[model samples]
Target: MMRITDHPVLGPLENKEVTIQFNGVDYIGLENESIAATLLANGIRTLRYSEKERKPRGIYCGIGHCYECRVTVNGERSVRACITPVKDQMIVESQGFQS
Candidate 1:
């Protein structure tokens, strides 16, 4: 039941879905949806760990302003997943101090 099997407000999430790779692992996501939303929908939390303090962080504002939702996209650093649309074959990786 990783998927949003049933939601009270949304009432069974259904939309155009796509597959994307996260840290080399494939996952099902919705097209045209924000990366953060897709990840959250699929039960992915703790987007990144703080470099200095190693503090866990995830979606806070749900907007693009916050950098907490930042993740590496196709080898690019500090890409905000909250604003980025899910693209097919896109490679996403968790932001961490060490690989």
Candidate 2:
């Protein structure tokens, strides 16, 4: 539903469907697309909870400068989703700030 059908400069993006598990929900996204882009495209706004207040946090900087989009990939902690590429059958867990 969130996939871009047409672009002004890039034109229609090719659809190569790939599945990624987020918070135990299976969602479809483009292959090789950044995890942050994929999550945003799928209407996933909150990627993690704040360390102290436990407030919801999502992609603040798309270039990995901000650590808001941190998620656990394949049991690896603190993986930045903004720069990480999506892989088939990847397990993504919404993580909170590590104390």
Reference-based lDDT, each prediction: 0.76, 0.81
Residue 57 displacement in candidate 1 (angstroms): 1.3
TM-score of each: 0.80, 0.82
Worst 10 residues of 2 by lDDT: 4-13
Q: Tell me which residue pairs clash in candidate 2.
A: none
At residue 3, what lDDT does model 1 achieve?
45
Give candidate 2's whole-model lDDT: 0.81
Expressed as tens digits, the lDDT of each residue in 1-99 for candidate 1 is 354434333345447778988877888886666777778877788788888888878888766777898899999999988777778778888887533
Give, for candidate 1, the lowest lDDT window spanning 10 residues: 1-10
Query: How much lDDT does candidate 1 score?
Result: 0.76
Q: Per-residue lDDT for 5-70 in model 2, tens only?
A: 543333454578899999899988887777777888989988899888998989897777888889
